[model samples]
Target: MSESEQLMVVDSTGQPLYPATRKKIHQEGLWHETFHCFVINHEEGHVILQQRAKQKKDFPGLIDITAAGHLLAGETPRDGIRELEEEIGLVRQFEQLFPLGVFLEELILGDLKDRERVHLFLTDESMPLERYVLQTEEVSRLIALPFSEFARLTDETAETFQTADQEIIHRDQFVPHPSAYFRRVNEGIQAYRVQQT
Candidate 1:
């Protein structure tokens, strides 16, 4: 995680532009690709979330996607499977994942302008929480929250998120992706559930 990432930069329309360092991409607001995977257990009504390590530069100590990483310069969305094992010690095959389509998000954190085409996927995991190994440099811990509750995460009236450990959190405790990002992910999860039944 200490090494600089070489990212494949692209235009807003997804046309290849050039390769650049992760720092350059953020500093210049250049569009880049990222891989996002959400692990869910539909029968148990839960989805896994990762708590970021306190030492992270961006969004430290926040709850975020179960497994995610920026795609390297020559990596495909399929290559993102490595993040599952790297971050959470869960090995997966590309064929075992569900496609959730690419999503676009633009954000500015102080002088950092982040633009990304997020390639999303979903995988089902129903294992006991303690069985998973976490890479402490990137993740603090993992939690499974009811999918029904997660759907209401961005609601104005939903003022708090109570974790499995009984720790209470506010909307700000989540990695600050736009509300649209959460909304679309919620819709995608719902649609996926419908297809399974």
Candidate 2:
């Protein structure tokens, strides 16, 4: 995504204020909108995670949600469904997405200040690893982690995960979202699994 791309800015209540360039919004600490989707496979008891491409402008090489992106100026939460297909090559209908909740998050690091109203969604879908045609500029690879193990790592209830490539030591590999945010995401996954059963 271009830093010059236009985005819808909003207030604390999520009421749209006006349009602003992505760069300006981040620079000014203006609240903007983002979409976060977590892909879960309850039957297999796993969740998908994507490794961001090293060339990404922000958070490069970090392991993040299954798919996520900023909502353009005229986009709604439903419109954000395209991100799943664009980022990870998962074409999904808007109805397949289950709304978790909207969360306001702020992060500041040196000159970068990000404030976003995150539209979170959960989807229970499983596909073969080869099915994902990753956009090399945005994503490097994808992995599946046991849902129970993910929850434990997020809560610091467990520390290490052995994957085919290498051993993952939670904090050393994953993106640094606040512990509560991870807890909320884990709970959302659990709740969705319960509803399915």
Candidate 3:
């Protein structure tokens, strides 16, 4: 394969298995490290979601985590954090965000096979949404769903929502289902709101 062609491997469970180098794994499928940041703007009662660029190899134009990236070879999880800042312009240290553990999974994105050891994080960060200097090739748009409305959307009969902006593109990406995580996160947000009330 050419340098541009990345090889992927999958474990028995179809999880991505990362190696100590950039080469393909001996086993079937591919291995990649991914970073996911669930950013909550507590004051605004909204969670930031990004619409991945259409040019992405997979899941393009779908609603995704606040930020994410693949871990380069010989790089630690910390390197993934740096990618978040580079990709989304959020400046923060790993210690500041709460690590939500890893989501080991495999997914087929288009013709490309993607198996990822996804590290998750949550942070309460304050910033002007407009100030986000988006990496155009990586992110197309950003949207903030009201905490209540987001939870409500999951409960409704509808299973998906049209992504914000242009208002016609519906999102269908579903590796780590948004509703699955949204439901869990909503509980925490709701409890916090109740306490304040």
Candidate 4:
């Protein structure tokens, strides 16, 4: 995302305040809106994860949600669907996304203070890992892990994941979200899966 891009700032109640540049929002600790999309392969019972590009401004080189990006000023949560294609080359229609829920996340990392209203979405879409045209500047690669294994790791009940090409250590390899956040996400995925059956 461009540093100069305008974003909507909101009060504690999520009411719009005023527009500010992306940089200003972070520097001022202003609450802003972002979107997170998680893609699940229901048939395979796995969730897709993306490795953020090392050059990213925040959380560089971390394993993150399937696709995520800031919602530009005046853009609705549904407008965020473009991020799937822009970040990972997955073209999805707004109607195809199942709304999971919105979450508020506040973090203070060094000089960056982030307060984000995250609009989460879930989708059961399967595609070959090799077929993903990753935006090299935003994402490095993609991986799929069994949802059960992912939940176990998040719950500290598992240690490592061994894939054909590499082994992933859970600790610093993934984003440092609160445990409850991961649990909620897992619950949402499971609920969607049950509804499908």
Question: What are the Cα lDDT values of the candidates?
Answer: 0.87, 0.85, 0.63, 0.84
TM-score winner: 1
Model 3 global lDDT (CA atoms, 0 to 1): 0.63
Candidates sorted by lDDT, best first: 1, 2, 4, 3
| Model 2, residue 26: C-alpha shift (Å) | 1.0
lDDT assessment of candidate 1: 0.87
After the best TM-score superposition of candidate 4, give how far the Cα of residue 26 lies from its true spot, in angstroms: 1.0
lDDT score, candidate 4:
0.84
Give candidate 2 misplaced runs (Cα > 4 Å): 156-159, 163-166
Write down the worst ten-residue block by lDDT for model 3: 1-10
lDDT of 4 at 35: 91
lDDT (C-alpha) at residue 43 in model 2: 77
Candidate 4 backbone clash number = 0
- Model 2 worst lDDT window (10 residues): 162-171
Model 1 per-residue lDDT tens digits across residues 157-196: 6868766556677888888887778787888788888989
The runs of at least 3 residues in candidate 4 whose Cα sits more than 4 Å from the true structure, single-residue gaps closed, are 156-166
Among all candidates shown, the one with the greatest lDDT: 1
Error of 4 at 180 (Å): 2.0
